[model samples]
Target: MNYTLHQLQIFLKITQLKSITKASEELHLTQPAVSIQLKKFQDQFPIPLTEVTGRKLYITDFGKEIAKAAERIINEVYAINYKTMAFQGEITGLLKIAVVSTGKYVMPYFLAEFMKRNEGVELAMEVTNKARVVRSLELNEVDFALVSVLPKKLKINTVPLMPNSLFLVGSEKLEFAKNATRKKIFENLPLIYREQGSATRNAMERFITKNKLSIRKKIELMSNEAVKQAVVSGLGFSIMPLIGIKNELKNEDLHITPIKGLPIHTTWNLVWLKSKKLSPAAAAYLEFVKTNKKDLITKSFDWVKHYDKERMLVKK
Candidate 1:
């Protein structure tokens, strides 16, 4: 029973991404190529490594044990490579990361600064939904993730990056006043919503349920951008994170109204699996984020203010 390092890497990536297509894209291989590698690895083990449940890929119990061993092997390999490179005085490697879609706007700025300081390092970033980001972190597919919602049962460390504000927004054509009271707003419009498993969707549901608001006739969309577009087309109103609607608010394409006594705050976090080993590059990047996160938070809030003067208006 023999398996190649490449096969292990592919299996690890598949487990991390939970999709052959995504793992292939990250590895720069075709789907067939990735499937072939994974098959070869599974053949080396007596037990099945993974199974497909509905549309999701799940690792078997035995596969989880194998993945643990594979992590140990890979960590040793990385340590050896890191020491060799250190001996040669070169600090270079790929830092693979996954970020939730809302983080897309702000993380790039911070990453650009980090790259400038560390010219030898390269980054491979995937902008994905919150569910995918959690799956990736749980499987050790990515070095780290930038997200707003943390999973409940995962033993992971999270560095608070910034505080996010969620708002209820509607199309300009909806005939709803921009300053309408929360009660009036709810009574007057149908809700537009993000699909199940979205952080925004979860937050919206909790808020609405807590306030005893009826959400029976809502149009659900899969992405924040899609939800925003639906609102622009007058499909319905939605609760969205401020990051997603900054440009629309700036251009007056969307109107926002606050819900009095609504709790809509969430903290963006830099998260990684608690027991996973970090490469030197990943560690350095984390340290960089920790040191400059205050500046990053302030800059993010600057955009928040530019889009919604009400945030500042209320502060006064």
Candidate 2:
């Protein structure tokens, strides 16, 4: 089939997002424009590539093969462009990343710094739970994924980026804040939990189970921001990543409830499928991350310390 690389790009995006509307938005093309290209691409093949059942889109087996091929072609094109740019002593290409929801606190700063250094690089990011991020990596929809918990089901390459410290957080006004060390305090306190399937939730659950902490009442929220807001309103105590709640604690909007066996420690990891070929941009990101990990973690810790000091001074 005679098809342009642009058509393959659109088709791959449609498969990744599973929606023409979302692909259009991501590609900065109108819905009709995306639809026209998709139709043209589909017409070249004898059998239909995709089928829509209700609002859900399903790629046929042939379509899946095409998408896999398209991804390889697209990455190879990027690799070629990267090699050409390297000859001129420049780094330029697209960098796609998928980050777990809790990574929102850290990934943006990293991206901002990396982008500043490599002005020619374009970025696309998706922030979701571990499940979706793992799926994206498996499908080659993202070049890398940032997460605290590695996917056990996949054979992936992992680089440890930093420590993810989780603590029990609550509004300072809560009675439990003053006596969080007491098991009864935890036994009596209502708990807010991250949604099921979340890495944060999984980690917290494992810790709680290991410590045998009894959560009297529990409610689940989907995002870290949501959980923080809920805790800020004194809805209940929740285990939160220290990075995510740094701002709230600094502003005195939240308090760390120092229960025993506190600060569940997990490693923040950069993961990708071992089988996927790394394009230049992706390889650069990996190297940048490897070389700069200490600085990134140090900067984050420094900020946390500054915030803690300021908050303590205010408390006095």
Candidate 3:
């Protein structure tokens, strides 16, 4: 039985996401279309490739083996294409990257520069939550992933790209805006926090535990934008990436509360699996980031300079 590469790619996505609808969304195919292709591909094999229990999908043991083979086939095909392009002295191919949601703010700036330099390159970027981004990395689905916090569970190589400091921000109208201590802020204010699985949330939790701060009243939101809006409307304070609040700070829509021992400094990293072989484009990008990370970070996040000035004043 012959299976097209496209079908294999679709099946790979399905296995990774464990849902037809999610795979279809990622592939930009209708669910029925994806299901039909998946069914046709499964028909080629006598044993079932996947099984569904209740609402969740599970890949059978045979499916796991097929998935591994599919990955090898995909990677080798890409490697050969890259070799051919290199032989022709061409700097052109697909550059797929997955970035944590907060990274979306700065990554496009660098991608724009990269694209400008390599006009023949095709770029695909997925802006997803950290959990999905990590899952994508685990599945070797992207050349690189941008994250603020490194996943301790994954054996990967990482390059520090820039600083990703977290700041406590709230509506400017709040009485405790200027000089609230960590305990004071946590004990009195209603804090708005990102959903449980977000990298931002994880960082915030670690900082809270380290500082022994307890949030008394809190509102949980799923997205950074939601948390920011909630804070703007005086719903609560939020710990947000400094990169994400440049506009709000400039417009005075929000104010950074200089709580003592605050503004947790973290670094954004470009990460990839240590064992996977890199494509030419990915290798070039890794080299480019290595050589130009400092300048790129400054260029993408120049507003941080102003924040630094504010932090200095807050200290005084």
For residue 279, model 3's alpha carbon misses the true position, in angstroms, by 1.3
Candidate 1 residue-wise lDDT at 215? 54
- Across residues 1-316, which tens digit of lDDT does each residue of candidate 2 receive? 7999999999999999989999999999999999999999999999889999998889999999999999999999987877787788888888999999999888886777788888768899999998889889888898999989888888999988777888777886666444335467668888888887799899888987887767789899989899889999988888889889877887889877655566778888888899989877788888898888788778756676543333221110
Q: Write candidate 1's Cα lDDT for 124-209 as tens digits.
A: 89987889888888888999988888888789988887777787777768876656556666766889877776788889988888
Query: What are the Cα lDDT values of the candidates?
Result: 0.81, 0.84, 0.85
- What count of clashes does model 3 give? 0
lDDT of 1 at 302: 71
Name the regions of candidate 1 deviating beyond 4 angstroms: 1-88, 177-181, 305-316
Decoy 1 TM-score against native:
0.68
TM-score of every prediction relative to native: 0.68, 0.69, 0.70
**lDDT value, residue 11 of candidate 3:** 94
Model 3 residue 230 lDDT score: 84
The per-candidate count of clashes, in order, stands at: 0, 0, 0
Q: Which parts of model 3 have CA positions greater than 4 angstroms off?
A: 1-88, 177-181, 309-316
lDDT score for residue 206 of model 2: 92
Error of 1 at 239 (Å): 0.5
